[model samples]
Structures are given as structure tokens and as C-alpha cells.
Target: MNINDIKMVGIDQNTPIEIRERVSFGKEIKKALLKFKETYNAEVVILSTCHRSEIYVYSENIALKTIKDFFIEYFKVTEDELGQYLYILTGVDAVKHIFRVACGLESMVVGEDQILGQVKNAISISQENFASGKILNKLFRDAITLGKKVRTETGIKDLALSISYIAVKFISDEFKDLNDKKAFVIGTGEMGQIAIKNLISKGTKVYVSNRTHSKAVDLKKIIPEIEVVPYDDKYVQIARSDIVISATDAPHYTIDYEKFIKVYKGKKICMVDIALPRDIDPKIGEIEGVSIYTLDDLKKTADENKKKRIGFINVIEKIIESAVNNFVNWFKTLAIEPQIKNINKFADVISEIEFERVINKLSNIDERDKKNIEIALKRVAKKMSDLMIKHIKNDIINKKYEEVAIDFIDENGGNI
Candidate 1:
């Protein structure tokens, strides 16, 4: 359970969205984690979202460079191309990074709630794929707990920022009024649904298109006024929309530039692509009277939202720091558990042996007297063992026993 065994290689808000999109695990995240396990025989979890792609590995056999090289080879990107964008973290740094991320401090929109779920999903997928082991399982579970705690105890959620919310806000800011605007949202996933609700709340008429029409219909059921456009005819609906937002997990461009150009009447449409791989083509932004925004473009709105939550940063950071220290201390305590168990076992064996010897020597000892003597002997042994364990733990906490009193156990011939 050495902290050094945990390492993270990642690129977050600092990296370019295009680069992130190229490296995202997407639908293959579970597969990639499985492959990581097969290759390194280590615990690994991949957290890929629109804003970041992180690989967390827990194993003495795996180096950060090994994971970096794995990324280069897996993403098929050259070293120079990927090297400059990566952030490598180890030990406590890695621990703090995950905690910060789970708490949404690392998000472009600080305190965004989506990332918490994404973090949960990342570890869950790894667990389901048998890719995450003891350390990561504990690490992620602790992170999730801290995430919930921060959200519950802090005012960071007052910022009320998310990719979906910000995407709509960005568009609403552009138009100044969304009361009568027509919004065509592609996809009915979490992001898309949130975007649709945001649009509707802005007094805008919302039309949704999904590959699964029933999902769109499901949205319509929630908001009867919401219209469901057939997925195949989404381009036609886009032509009539004042604003179009795409938030889907599709691999390829959902709205191709050429196809969009054919339907685009140059009527001044605002398109927001909140998808990782980018649902809308980048080239569409070049067309006159057509404005496009992606996850990267939402940074301006995120910056504004960050100002609103600046005061909460310190509070959130304190919570995260406390959680990180707790996790580290837990790992430290876990490291010496075997030694503690051995000591307790040794004490019990010696107490039982001495108790039998003394009781055997007593001629008129009743069952009650023998029981009291046995209890006294066991209690003495337990107290001694507890004191020794307490000192060992203090040594561990003080950084005075890196090998965790293993030498003492070895000297005692602890085969018992």
C-alpha cells in the first residue's frame, strides 16, 4: 500500500480539446482498461470526459513512463505530440489530484456536478472489467465520498455550471433573449437532456433528435411542449433552428460540414457541440452567419462562472485536502495491518500457553478461578500488544518506520 505505487498520467483543461478528443476512451474505455490490466498486470482506471482524459495506475511494477508509452501507442500519437500536453503525478500528488477532480476543482467549470458522476462511472467500469484492484478501489470510493461531502457542505454548487448549462448560457448570452428562439438539440443523453431543460427554462421552443427516437419521445413525455424530430430528419430541423446543440457519444461527426452546408441557409444559427469527439464539424464554424462552440469554447463562460465561485475555492480545497490526508493515513495504517495481526496472534498464543501452564499447576482451582486467571492473562497480553502496535503506528506516522517494524517481526521468528 505504498503511496508511490499510485501514479496518474493525464491531460485536463490545460490540454487542447482536439487532442483530448483524439485520446478519449469513449466507448472503448472498459476495453482499454482491460487491455491495461492484461499488459501490465496492474490495476488501472481511465477517466475520460469532454474536458479530460486521465489514466490512474496502481502497481509497483508500472511506471508513469510505461503508462505514458502505453498512451502514445494506444492513441497512435507521437511522443512529441503527446508529451507536452501530459501531466504526470505520483504518490500524494496523484491522491490529491483525484480528490480535487472528484470535487470538481479541476473542472473547467469549477464545481460542476457532471464530473462527480463521471468519476464514479470511471471506477465502476474498471471494477466491472476487473481492471481495478484494492488500492484504486479504495482510492476511488474515498474520492466519491469526498465529492459528495464537499457538495453537501459547501456553496460551490451555487455557481450552477455544467457543460450543458454553460452551452445554453453561452448561446443565451449571444442572443440576449431566448423567449421565442427555436432550439434543436441532438441526442437525449444526460448532457442533451440538461441542455433541453435549460433551453426550455429560458422560454425557448426545444426540439430533440436522438438515434433512439423513443428517448426523444421520453423527453417529450416529460415536457409535453418539447417536440421530437426524427433522427434522420435532424438536418431539416437544424435548418429551422435558431440554435442547435449536439451532445452525443457518437464517434464520428454527427453533423458533417458538407451536409450542414447544404441545409444551412446562412440564417445565423448558433451550434454548440458539447460532445467529446465533437458532434458538429469544426469546419462549420468557418461558414459566415454560422457560429459554433465546443467544449473548448465554453471556457469563457466557465471563467465567468469561476469568478462567482472564487470564494468557495478555499473551502472546497480544505475539504479535499482533509479527505486526501485521511486517505493517505488510511493507506499507512493498512500497510501495518499484517504486522498488527501477527503481534495479536503471537500474544494470544503466548497467553494461552502460559494460562494452561499456570492453571495446570493449581491443585484446588475452581472453574471460576481458572476463568478469572485466564481473563487476566489474556488482558495483559492484549494490553502489551496494543501498546506495541500504538508505538509502531506512531513510528509509521512520523516517517520513522518505512519498512513498518518488519525487522522486529523477523527477529521474533513470527512463523507462529
Candidate 2:
């Protein structure tokens, strides 16, 4: 397939969290991948994270509108609901977008390292479901390599900024110091763990909880100083804490408005919900003496990080550009290889026919002479095949006869 067949349609940090939440695959991502595969018969990879819900596909016939329609039907949302939030990218633009995303250049917290792993996980999930094919597999593999290269060659990840780090940093801004504060963190996943560790680094008395008690116990084992609260008893610990951060992959809200109100003591508290589906209900933000933050709120800290690290952005962009070019060059060969093979096959056929016609007239020739003539004809065919391939490649690189070169190959050689 051509590079233009590589397409991506989704919403990112630009979309409001309310709308973003509606489109997130969340725990249903694998199911979504299977559905896309069944419906469109395309290579699909869904990258659903706290900041984005991107569906990437590689197919020759699936139109952008088809994916848009599938998104609307599957998510059960109308065009009005999506409302200018979705982005559509294809060809080189799609390649550049993914590379940027993997390198953390497109993240809300620019150059945040977590997105690299998230991208890897998205592709891994797609592979596990058997939804990804050669094109998407190679695209994602290149993206991951570029991600690692950017981090290694540049100082983009030097600050080690992440959504979790920024969420805690937001709260840290409100308080003079975290050393005297107690934090109750829900979920022990990557984001949850990052939040917990960042809080501990600030010398905050951290109480961790997870739906799986063993995970929370494991976390506490890693940091013996931190306290572990039972998942059901989280509300008790949350009430006692000055700060509460919920960052779980649960589909439903972990701290809904109804349940949180029961344990509400009217004491001033700050809650941060960093999960994509959102662990804390938005309505809880309306409570008296309560302040809540979601992924959107971290934009402020992200902006500050961007300003401090603006210089690294240029370096990152150069690296992304180089990576994009390399991937595109490799991708071009997918389309060209079949044409080259056809030309070589055509050459072989022509050489055999001409050799037979001439050999018939040279019946008196020795077996050695026949063999030498056969070798000469084969060498001539190989030379002609190599010459045509070189010219076609040059034309593709120049973009001068790229369209016509394929047509030429199709007409002169493909059928033969």
C-alpha cells in the first residue's frame, strides 16, 4: 500500500475532557481493535491515553469518513457531539504525527517520557488482538525506535516531566510545602505509581490504595515508609488526607459524588483525577471547601514546562523530521518492490524466449556453447532489470515520474 493509506483519526488534548472521556476506549480498547478489524478489515491500532484517543489504520480502501462514521457509531456519539474535535491525518503527516507523539513532542507536558511507553503499549495491544498488519507494525516499530533515539540523543526528557508529576506539582504550587501534608493515592498503575513516588519525593506522608490489594502491598514493600490503605477503606484514608489523587484504569469513577459526600467532613481538600475515564467524578468539584483537578488542569504546569524546555523542542523536531524521512523512504519500497519483481520476471521470460529461438538455429552447437550462450542471455537480462530498477527508484526519490513509473511497470512488465 502507498503511504497515503496510513491514516489516523482521533481527538487529543485539544478536545475537552468531557468529550474526550466519551470517546476513550479505556478498558475496552482490545474489543474496539477487534471491532475495527471485523468492520473495516484493516490494520488497526488504538492509542487511548489520558490525553488522547487515536485510532490509526493502514488500508487502501477505507476512507477517512468511514473511520469517522465507525467512531461515531461505536462510541454512540453524533457528529454534533464530536463537533470539530476530531483530527484526520494521512501519508507523511500521519507518519510525522506518530513519531512526534512517541517522542513526547506532542504531549501536553512536552517531552514527557510516559507517552513513549504508552505508544508501545498501544501497538502491543493491537498485536495481541491480531488487528495490526505489516504496514502498521512497521510504522509503530519505527515510532518506538524514534522515541528511544530522541530521548538518548537529546535532553528532551531531562526534566522527567509527566502528567502525574505535573498534577502533584499543581497541588504543590497551592501549598507552601508538602512535607507536612498527607496524600491518599488510588490505583497502583504506572500513572498512579508516578504520582505516589512524586508525592513521596516531596516528603508528603503518602497512603496508597489499589483495587488489587497485592499491588498496593507491593508498592508499600518498595517504599516501606508509605502506608497501604485497603481499597474499600480508601474513603476513610482520603478523608484524613489533605490531598487525594485517583489515577486508575477503572471504567467507572472510583470516587463518585454520592459516595464521596458521605465521607465529606467539610474540611478543605484537594483531589486530582488523572485517569482518562477519570477516577474522581466531576460533580465532586462542586462541593464546598473542595478543590479538584483533572487532566485539563495540568495544562498550566505543562505550559510552564514548555517554556523552560523550549530550546529542546527544536532539537526534537529535527530528530523527528529525520526519522519521518527514513520511515517514508522505507515505506516507498513496499509499493516499488512488486513492480521491481515484475520487471525482473519479465526480463527472465524475454531472455528465455530469445535464447530458445536462437538455439533452434544453432543445433550443431556443443552443450558447452549452449551453456555459455544461456549464461550470456541471463546476464544481459539481469543488467537490463537492474538498470530499470535504478531509474524507477531515482524517479520515485525525485517525485518527478513516481506516478508514471508505476504505470510504466504495470503496462510493460506486471502481466508478463
Candidate 3:
């Protein structure tokens, strides 16, 4: 198999929020992957989150244009807009990118733990849709393994630098004391859960709300002091709270600017939106007496946290490099084993043909002598074939036999 056959294309936090928001995939990610399979006949896995939307494809004959076209159609973006935002990676670069992403090295907040679970969920979804084949299955599994190893082996994740945690830190920096502040949290997803936990730890009273009220109730059970507001009453609770953080998986805006303008009193309020499609409308930020922070806005705090932990980066990078090399070596071995077997089979076939020719010419020889000669010839052939096979295997492992191996297969009619 060719290592360069794997490809990844996507937009991430590095892209402007305007473009990232335009290209972000949400619940329709599965439909998008299925469309890619139907259109390009490619095996794919999609990883879509608030910070990134990436598709990893494993196919023998797929072009960068084909992958880019899928995104242009899916995201409804023009070629110029897509070209400015899209990034393409192939082969070992693709593998290394995945490993780094899983390890949280590529996250907006370095050492954030949420990305690992997001990646695993993406892999599981791909498996359920049969969009993942042999190569992707192995690739994703190895990435997860490296993610776990990096976390355990390095000091990267010692501090809580997640976006949620950073949002709370931003709030704390603004209001020197949160002991008496009331905060409202929307959505009980991973980010919401972390935000609620951090808020409570800061001595802030928290109220939670979700489209599914049951999840809000469940969250309340974890922190009994926290109040659970019904989905419809989110606006009323928002008016009462000092801090409001909205992070839902809704496809559209949960908080309309016009609606918020009516309910929002002329009191100072801090709003933190950590959703991709944006739970709170951007227009809401324009209103007087209200301050809004999106995932992009939290980068300042993320950058500060990253600088403090910059020393551990080299250590984690070394770990990722070692893991990536091991995975590549294993893949190389798998690719070469079939050729090695075919070579040995060809040697056996030639030995048998020559042995038959000699036996036919020795018709006067006795049966016992003929059997003894056959045994000796077989031993000689086995030794010579074994030595040649060993040398070829070593050359392949050292990556020095590609041309010769291809020539051998071509000369033998592509078979033993």
C-alpha cells in the first residue's frame, strides 16, 4: 500500500472565525461523509467541533481537488473563499497532524482534554456508517493510543487550560470576586459541564438550562446547589444572572438579538459563547451594557496559558515523533510482507521446474538415488532462497529496495 494514499482536508481555528464558522459542520457531518463516499468513492472519517472541521480520507485514487470540491459544495463556498481557508495534508504529514490533534497540541487551548473524546466520537461515527476502512481504522486507533500516551507521559495537561476553564478565568479576571455572583450556563455538553464545574469552584452560584430539560436536571444532581431552568425560561434566567455562558449544539442561533434586546435589562452582563454556529447571535454583542466573548475571544487567555507551559511542548513533541515513527514502521512492514511472500513462492516454482527437468533426463537412475538427489537439491534451494529473502526483507525495512522490488514483480509477470 502507498503511504501517500491518505489525505486530510479541513479548516481550523487558524482560519478566521468568519470562514471557520462558514465551513463548520455540525449534526450534518454524517450526511456530509456519506455524500463524499457517494461522490468520490472515498473512505472517510470526519472530525467536526467548535474549533475545527476536518475530514480524513483513505483511498487509492483521490485528488486534492476532489476533496476540496466536496467542501465547496457542502459548505456552499466559492473557490476563492475555500482556497483561503482550506488546508490539505497527505501521507505522513496527515498522520502526524492527527496524532498532534489527538494529543491536544493543535487545540486552541494547548493541553485541553476535550479533543480526545471528540476524535474518538468521530471515529465511532465513521465506523457506524462504514465510511472507515482498514487504513482509517488502524490510523485512528493509533492516534488515540498516542493521545493517551502523551497525556500520561508528559506534564502538558497538568493545568486546566480548556476553553471552558479559560472562560471562567476571564470572568474571574474581570470581577475580582465571584463569591456572590450569579452565573447562568446554557447546554450541558462537555464544554458546558466543564464551565459549570469551574464556576462552582469559583464560589459562583450557577443555573443550568438545556433544550432537553432532563440533562439540565442531571447536571443539577452533580451540583445540587445549582438551579435547573427550563429551556423556555433561559431568557428570564439570563436577565437575572451576572454572567451567562451559552454553549449548545444547536444548528441555529438560540438567542435572537431582537428577542434579547427586549428581555435584557440595562444592567451590565458578561456573555461567553463557546459554540461553533454560535448559540448567541453576534448582533447581541453590539448592544450597550452587554459584553460578549466567543471561542475566538478566549484565545487571549489560551495564549497566556500556553506560554506558561511552553517548556513542556518539546517533551510532548518528542513523544509524538517517536510514536509516529513506530506507527509508520508497522505500516511499512504490512505493505512489504506480501511482496516478500511472492518472491519466496517464485523461488520455489523455479526450483521445482529445474528439478523436474533434471529428473526427466536421469531415467536410468534408480528410484532410491533419485529420491536422495531430490532431497539434496531441495535443501540447497531452501538455503539460497532463505538468504536472498532475508536480504530483500532488510533492504525493504531500510527503505532501499523500492525500485528493485517493483522491477522484480514486473519481471515475474506481477505474480509468483
Scored by lDDT, the top model is: 2
lDDT string, candidate 3, 139-207, tens digits: 999989888887887757654568888888778777889998999999999899888876876689999
Give the range of the ten consecutive residues with the poorest summed lDDT in model 2.
153-162
Candidate with top TM-score is: 1
TM-score of each: 0.63, 0.59, 0.57
lDDT of 2: 0.86
* Cα error, candidate 1, residue 117 (Å): 1.9
Report the lDDT tens digits of candidate 2 across residue range 1-416: 57899999999988987898789888899999998899889999999886899999999999999988888888999999888988899999999999999998888667766788889999999999999999899999999999998888776665445788888877887786999799999988878877876687678999988999999997775567689889999888878889999988999999978888988899889999898888888998999888999888786666666675777788888888988888887777667888888999999999999999889987689999998999999999999889988888877866778889999999898987
Q: Mark the 10 consecutive residues where model 3 has the least summed lDDT.
A: 407-416
Model 3 misplacement above 4 A: 161-308, 339-394, 401-416
Who is ahead in lDDT, 2 or 3?
Answer: 2
**Compared to the true structure, candidate 3 yields what TM-score?**
0.57
lDDT of 1 by residue, 1-416 (tens): 57898999988868876687678777889778878888899989999876788899999888778998998789998888776888899999999999999998887657767788899999999999889988999999999998888888885754656778888878977899999999999998878877887687678999889999898887775557788899999889999999999999999999998888888887989999999988888999999898998898786666776776776788888888888888887788787677778888999999999999998898988999999999999999999988988888777776786574767854552667
Candidate 2 wrongly placed segments (more than 4 Å): 160-308, 342-391, 400-416
